[model samples]
Target: MSRTAWRWSRRPSAPSSPRSRPFRSKPGTWRRCSGANAVMSCRSPAGRRRHRPPEEATMQPEPITCRLIVEAVAEFYGLSIVDLLSHRRPQRVTRARQVAMWAAKRLTTRSLTDIGRFVGGRDHATVSHAVRVVDELRERDADFRQQTDDVVLAVEATARTLARFHANGPEDVDPVAVARRILATPRGVPIVSIPEITALASAVSAQELTDSSKMMTGPMKRFRSEPRDRESEFDLYRAVAEVLEADRALKQAQWTHGERGAQARLDRGLKALRETFERETEHVD
Candidate 1:
């Protein structure tokens, strides 16, 4: 009979050769040891030694984005991206939509409500229902489950491809140039409506509530508590400023470069956002 000597030490575990390694714990906190002993964690619950490759244990694939997942799922199920996002409910379109919801929920950090917004403007409850329906169908029908799996697999592949492309894409791309191009676009970019808000707050006299008001002159109007309070809310001021700047640029582009519809929709969306906010200003409690 031959006997083998195994030396175990407090170091990062590896499939080959015992060597010094940095533990994932606090710096210089690992115990130093040397002997023909094995790490207890090296053994599985079944009493078998388990070894995993470094990549398998520590390397995680980049997160797949919601957009890529939606595109891939739609393509895999033979549905157009429009059909996937549309309010239509043909059986085939519905299945693809459900699978898309499932994939977005599984692969992205976006909330159910966000998933709903992307997938046909449904609510979080609708997204939850779609996910549940897909789960039950996967459990009850093998073919349906396989189809869902295929979509998921396809999405994963698409994400990896996109990750690779982005990783290798231009590192020196100029953000200024990008901004110029977008601002110069005749139709402009897609618009996201600003939050509809009423008066942010009403001016109220604090004198009624506190003696401090007596020391102060005038109504002690409830001015903003903090000058920087707007920091927490959407930067409507900055956005409006940007739109104004963009509008000026667009007008120049139209005048000099013969651009048309440069600020048509963009101007309308900004105006609506401002009007809504002005009308919905918050009131004193």
Candidate 2:
């Protein structure tokens, strides 16, 4: 009715609107907002697709190890691994052992000497003879060839299975259980010597374990007196000293930094054990 009232009324009637409601995603849709400006992404649970990495079909299989080949051959011939490695000259065991050596030669990159050492405490000559024997038998005897083929096939299948297991996240596999199964040494076997060795190691004094140089004096003297005949004895003594030294290092590491620190020294000891024994000096004298 008045000038001020007419001016307010004439000015665009406050843009007639309904009350504002809070922002919401559509029914069955999930929403997530991020960033300063609140950018949002929405997806319906029913229509959502999960993304996954593509399967590695072209992944190469794990390499076949000598241990795997030996175990496979042993199992194929219905013989225990220990029997295969033993010096027994029974027909079945000899054949199985020979076949295992041959398979190890074919499947792994280990030297013949290494194969011999692993199969038994044998030398390279023994392994060479075994390989030749297996080759000759396989070539002349069809039945033998067939049997060897079957053993190789079993080994390959085992390798594939292992590869698949590792590729699929082998977190479920217990390493200790696997080792126990593979190293199932029977009662009264030479494995009993392990306890004897442990006892001997325990009998070593703290001074001897710490200062291996002191332990080496007697062995070195014998080695210097008879470099040829006493060589093996001296070597054995050196090995004991090395073991004691390793034990000292491990104990020290455990005391200073715990198991994690000691693990490195333990690995070094194991590596030393796996290596071929050699004298630092050919003739101590």
Top of the candidates by lDDT: 2
For residues 1-285, write the lDDT of model 2, one tens digit per residue: 999998998777554444555566775444332221132223233335433223325546668766677668877877654456556566998889899889889877889977776665568998899899999999999999999999888878777777767743111122233335446864534333342342233223222322343434544565456546566665665565666576556655542656455545645654453341334444453
As for candidate 2, its clashing pairs are none
Q: Write model 1 residue lDDT over 35-112, tens digit each, in one string.
A: 112343454444456765444355455576655676687668765554566555568978888888888898778899
Cα-based lDDT for every prediction: 0.54, 0.60
Q: lDDT of candidate 1? A: 0.54
Which portions of model 2 miss their true places by more than 4 Å?
A: 1-56, 167-285
Tell me the TM-score of each prediction against the true structure: 0.40, 0.41
Count of clashing residue pairs in every prediction: 6, 0
Task: Give the range where candidate 2 is weakest over 10 consecutive residues by summed lDDT.
Answer: 168-177
Off by over 4 Å in 1: 1-60, 167-285
